[model samples]
Target chain A: MDKILKSLFDFQRFAGESALQSIITSVEERFPANEEKSPRTALTAEEMDQISAAGNAYLQMEKDKWENLVNGGN
Target chain B: MAVIDGEEVYLLYRDKVRGYISQHVNQREEVEDLCADVFEKVVSSLDTYDSTKASVSTWIFTITRNRVIDFYRRNREHAELPEELASTEMLDAGLLREETLRELAEALMKLSEEKRTIIILRYYNGLSLKDISDKTGISYGMVKVKHQQALKELKKIMKI
Candidate 1:
């Protein structure tokens, strides 16, 4: 069952990528990447900490609810 | 989603979701805030997740996409160019175009859901072709063939 599911998802992802690439290529043909010099800055350590904290808290809260559904309901 | 697995799941998805969120947003603080909202939506909707319909990453990306739209709608006055290029200079120069992404998104939606999944995994999620095959347990050759066929269909759809 897992194998079948994976194949299904894999094929879908490829098709989506192909379509996106095509559109990008056509636009790049018009306006190539070499012309643009976009800055690539890394996120700060403090922001990373905040993201981790938010994710951890949300997961714990949701886990408690899921456990309640599984144990209490079941 | 077991209680014990919740943190593990969050850890697994945190960076990817961050990357996805950062693509739309400008400031790191804003990304963190939107990322929180996205995961919050994830956990809240965990009960409705159907693995047969989409992978965790695809499902998460969809949520991120919607949140981006909401973010844009609420902050239309902000005029922050998408992080896909993330350069106000380039945006002002008319170099990085959102219309290109919009067209690609339109083409992607026209594809069957399965085909859309492959594109999202590869291009959106940045998974390698081999990684996709391994994850799916699909033969490498078959994966390549499917990708080629998908490209052909997409080209036809885009009338390219």
Candidate 2:
């Protein structure tokens, strides 16, 4: 039973933004986002900074990886 | 196409990915960490992405979902993982395309209002039949019946 339900729910992951948006539209129609308390809270400034730093780090890592490959991994 | 510009992809998806992580993770620091981890993965695995199989947003969503699942598994050792978060085998790549999802959306729209509501509640919201019964004020038996009917209808419409 659980396995069946998992399979049913899993397919939605394949749904693109537009299709997922439609399902979300239906979900919100039945269950309004504001009517219920959401777990998400406004991100603090520090957290935002942290995320920015992480992005910069990843960008640098990706750049280095590409450079290494281009340089024949020297 | 391979992601030649990692920063571009990161900038585009960072907020959306952060929002999703914040929903599943309570700690502010952990949310930030997970968001970073997800983007790091996106950057590292850029070569593996096939745009034809799924859209960039869908790919990011899958990565985010998996990270949250891993977070929960690591943190909540004693508690049962929600059925919604439990990993399932990836379906065939052809079926994972946006076209299939569009077809599914069309089929879902064709369902009766009652059946559509039940299906969205069950699958989209990850609510169990009993939970749907309580929320909709329907009896458990009827919710189950309607859920089955909705699935049957979808199968017929989709020929799946």
Candidate 3:
């Protein structure tokens, strides 16, 4: 129940990028944007590449750990 | 078969993840670190993901939100976390669908104008009831009551 409520509240961000834009358009049509800032923009491609590298490295480390455990540190 | 492709998922939702994180955390480095953490968790939990229940987008965002909430809990920089995000229960994958959001939007449309605005301000904008009162010129107590009433109406309408 609370989870549903939280997801509903988080719809703006949790709906993902394209869907969020549509929701904003639908809502803003009813209530005009005043002083509030528009929703935050998505991260840039370059930034994403850097993070992707880091994330892939972490995955590799985990994979290595599993293999080592299976091999009993041989 | 591989449960999920880590790099593909990272490429797909990285923007959404960082956008959500930047709302709560300002430092660029911390934002990138948190984004990486979300993907790592995605990879680790890939086998557990049940796509029939929730879209990958919904699942990733749930993890992303929890990461932000955890960050705030650890640092206490925000003074107080929004109760909506603070006490979020374990992800109930079935209920966190994109359709639920559409239903919520439709439900908000049914609400009176004042109630709708209060709900959006409190949740979408992450404003507190008192902050809402200050901004809208409503008394604090009135704002609090309306916020609760709005939630109750939403629950009934969404049949949650």
Candidate 4:
């Protein structure tokens, strides 16, 4: 019974993988125009600064959350 | 203590989150938006996150799953039910290949909100049974059983 189940699962995994490949291919074909677009965007100095600040703020918030959760609010 | 860097978090979990969302969500743009929302929620709610109870990946996945469920619930009225539910055909092979994902999305839309949640957390997110139990506040055994049942139900709908 376990072997049968395993084989079935293996088949399902294969099907899922094939389906995923097809989906990715379809998406890529539909979005071929996206290839013309540059993946990198130029960030001005101010924009870079803002991004850095935001990153710092996000890190602080995560730290605070972790501390609170671990310290039990003491 | 060293802080958890947002960029590091993005590096570690972005691909996994995108993969999870893509498997379940049919819309390309929505997946991007949902991924942003998941990370935003993770950053905002980091204070409440308990690392010992659940890994950061599991926690973020829970948030992502909840966001997807909420999106479905909000849009449920406008979504059409798939034709297979009404037909005698056990599974639609072409539809499974073409529309199975969308159907899975709709089936997920049909699940009682909580069950849909557990299914995502366990399968898509790859959370451990114990982590799910802790995160959701359900017993470990119940989490395992429910995880099995949820997979079974999803498989049935996807005709896997």
Candidate 5:
């Protein structure tokens, strides 16, 4: 029973991965033709600053939450 | 760069989360958005994470599954699914790998939200029954039964 279940699961994993790759490939192929030549675009300075700020905020929030929980705020 | 195991979790589970969203969501753009949302939720909820109850991958899947359910609920109220999805072409199980996946996805889309979620968590995420139960707040016994039923239903839909 376990072996059968495992086999079925393995097949399902293969099927799911194949499906995801298909979706990603299809989406990649559908990118704007003009944009294809410059697939890699640089983040603007302001956009990079915003990303960095968001990352820092997220890290701080995680730290604060963990600290509170550990300190019996749960 | 290093902060109390954040990088390890990201490196370990990022692809798994993306794959989960891609397999379960309808649109490619939504998949990308939901993948980011899943990680954001994961980051925020990291304090509550209990490794003893479930692995990080299973935790991520739980978040993705809930988000997909919410998407369906919102969309079902506003739009009708494409009719092509209801046809036998979308049920084919032996098409090329890519096409078959699309068919499998279509089949999954036809299932109830609960059923689709259980199937994805159990099969696609490789989560154990107990882990699924812990993540979903369902019982272990219920997870086993639901998983069995979900697979049976999927197999029937795929005609496999």
Candidate 6:
């Protein structure tokens, strides 16, 4: 009797856990990070090439981005 | 492919991330700090980031959401609001579902500590009943009963 009861409870616990995980997954899938309509102002080909050239030597994207943000004054 | 700079990502994502985090926290100031942390993580993780898997914004916001959850864990004692519930935009069923989930999380908080612990162990941690019983030092039958009771309480809480 003891073993049978434990087995039943064990099953219940497994099902419950699975359900919770699904609910959690559902919630995540339902929400997204951004709803922005437009992309950022386009990087000109020259600007892109400059970033690319700098990248070949050193200027990482992070630095370029920060510079742009500062320059853009936002 | 030009790597996305953290600033560009932060500039584009700041508002969305702020909106999402604000749902969890009451303070306005901390949101900016958390946004910075999220961007910092983005910069550090950029090499491994894959656009194929998720949009860049989605990826950053996921980090932002996680930082908020961590903040809550470190600062708040009874906070059970999961990061998944942070959407400000409404879905067709969004309002009611959000409220129910919020209440459900709080309801879990309202359960007896033991019952709440079992449910979290079994559900949140995805532990098997046997594992939970072993971990908590409770008998298997008792763990099952507590978890079942907790679920019932969660349902009752949601219903009301």
Candidate 4 docking class? incorrect
After superposition, the stretches of candidate 1 with alpha carbons farther than 4 Å from their true spots are: A1-74, B1-4, B80-153, B156-160
DockQ, all candidates in order: 0.03, 0.15, 0.15, 0.01, 0.04, 0.01
Comparing candidate 4 with candidate 5, which one achieves the higher DockQ?
5
Top candidate (TM-score): 2
Best by lDDT: 3
Query: In Å, what is the interface RMSD of model 6?
Result: 16.0
Tell me the spans in candidate 4 whose CA falls farther than 4 Å from its real position: A1-74, B1-3, B80-160
- Cα distance off (Å), candidate 3, residue B2: 10
> If both were scored by lDDT, which would come out higher, candidate 4 or candidate 5?
5
What would the per-residue lDDT of candidate 6 be over residues B1-160, giving only the tens digit for each residue? 2377777876776776777667567778987788778777888998888765655644564576568767876777767654233321112222222223344456656878677666655544446889777666889999888877876776676563
Question: What TM-score would chain B of candidate 6 score versus the native chain B?
Answer: 0.48
Model 5 chain B weakest 10-residue run by lDDT: B84-93
Poorest lDDT segment (10 consecutive residues) of candidate 1 chain B: B87-96
**Model 2: colliding residue pairs:** none
Residue by residue across A1-74, what tens digits does model 5's lDDT show?
22332333333342344554443334334332124343678899999999999999999999998998999855
- lDDT of each residue in A1-74, candidate 6, tens digit only: 12222222222222223433444444334322232557689899999999889877575667788899999996
The residue-by-residue lDDT of candidate 4 on B1-160, one tens digit each, is 2246677888877887777666556889988998899899878876777765554544565566567666665667964322211121232223322233445556565556566666555443345678667667889988777667766776676565
Q: Given candidate 1, what's the lDDT at residue B145?
A: 74
Cα-based RMSD of candidate 3? 20.9
Residue A18 error, candidate 2, Å: 3.2
Q: What does candidate 5's lDDT look like per residue over B32-122, in tens digits?
A: 8887787788778787877655545445555665666566556887644322222212332223233445666677677776666666565
Span of 10 residues, lowest total lDDT, candidate 6 chain A? A1-10
TM-score for predicted model 1 compared with the true structure? 0.39
